[model samples]
Target: MSRRCELTGKGVMVGNNVSHANNKTKRRFLPNLNDVSLMSDTLGRTFQLRISASALRTVDHRGGLDAFLAKAKDAELSPRALKIKRDIAKAQAATAA
Candidate 1:
């Protein structure tokens, strides 16, 4: 899999590393990603995602996986997360009906 955050779309960044002799080398700055299993209280299920540490903190700040998905922009989410968001919405609708 690519080194990218599924939630925040964070990915590797390109930069140059400078040495003491003013020599520069191409370098890649990778995002801090972790494979995490986030549980949903409404669906009573857990979803595994590869996300950045920042995204995890945001999820926690937003209260949970559901809340984060509900408020996050669709363009910022990965395809898997988009599907999960839709499923959560459908489940919530079913429970309400």
Candidate 2:
């Protein structure tokens, strides 16, 4: 598996590291990811995925698990993670009021 977030689609970003002497070196900043088991209402199963911490936070902030998943679907998320995110997003929206 790659160092990518299954939920937010986070990946490695490339950049340059500069020094006071104007020296530059190639560098990369990786997203914060975690391995988690998400329950999917659509499939009625649990799937394990690697997701970014930020993506998880976005889901939590928007509403709950279900609502978060819905947002991911709208964003054209990965096929493997779609069901779980959708379920979570819906559940979140329902709980919000």
Candidate 3:
């Protein structure tokens, strides 16, 4: 996978660094990405993602991951992770029952 934030769509930006003496060099500004498992207060479950800190901040600002997730109605998620979350929910429901 590319070095990108799944939440904010942040990726490496290519640019040139110019010095006062007119010396130019290549540079890259990397996104602030972090892997975290966030529990959804609404779903009553957890999901992991490689998201940027800014996107995480937006989630926190809105309320939590749930709010962010709700807003991200079209966001993509890994199939394996989705299956794991579904299985966990099923198990929890079985236990509760």
Candidate 4:
């Protein structure tokens, strides 16, 4: 898989590495991604996701995986994450009914 955050869709950023002599070199700034297993209360299951550290913190801040997914924007999420988001919504709706 590519170096990208599944939840936040954060990927490598291109930049320049400047030396002391004012020489510029190409550099890639990668997101701080971690493979984590997050448990969902509504779904009663755990999911493995490669997410960024900031996204992990955001998930915690929002309470849990369910809340984060509900509040996250579709454009910002990867295809896999978007599918998971849809599943989460379905599970929540089923539980609510």
Error of 4 at 78 (Å): 1.7
lDDT scores of the candidates, listed in order: 0.95, 0.70, 0.70, 0.90
Q: Could you give candidate 3's per-residue lDDT for residues 1-97 as a string of tens digits?
A: 7788776567899999999998999999988889888777645768778888888888789887655655553445345434544555566578689
Worst 10 residues of 2 by lDDT: 67-76
lDDT winner: 1
lDDT of 4 at 43: 80
For model 4, residues 14-89, the per-residue Cα lDDT tens digits are 9999999999999999899899999887788899999999999999999999899898899988887788889989
**lDDT-best of 1 and 4:** 1
RMSD of 4: 1.0
Q: After superposition, how far is residue 88 of candidate 3 from its true place, in Å?
A: 14
Residue 34 CA displacement from its true place in model 3, Å: 1.0
Please list the residue runs of candidate 4 whose C-alpha ends up more than 4 Å from where it truly belongs after superposition: none
Deviation of model 2 at 74, angstroms: 5.3
lDDT of 4 at 56: 97
- Local accuracy of candidate 2 as per-residue lDDT tens digits, 27-92: 999888888775555445667777888887786697745556665544546766665555565765
Question: What's the lDDT for candidate 1?
Answer: 0.95
**Candidate 2 regions off by >4 Å?**
39-45, 73-76, 83-97
Q: Compare candidates 1 and 3 on lDDT and give the better one.
A: 1
Deviation in Å, model 1, residue 97 alpha carbon: 2.7
TM-score of 2: 0.69
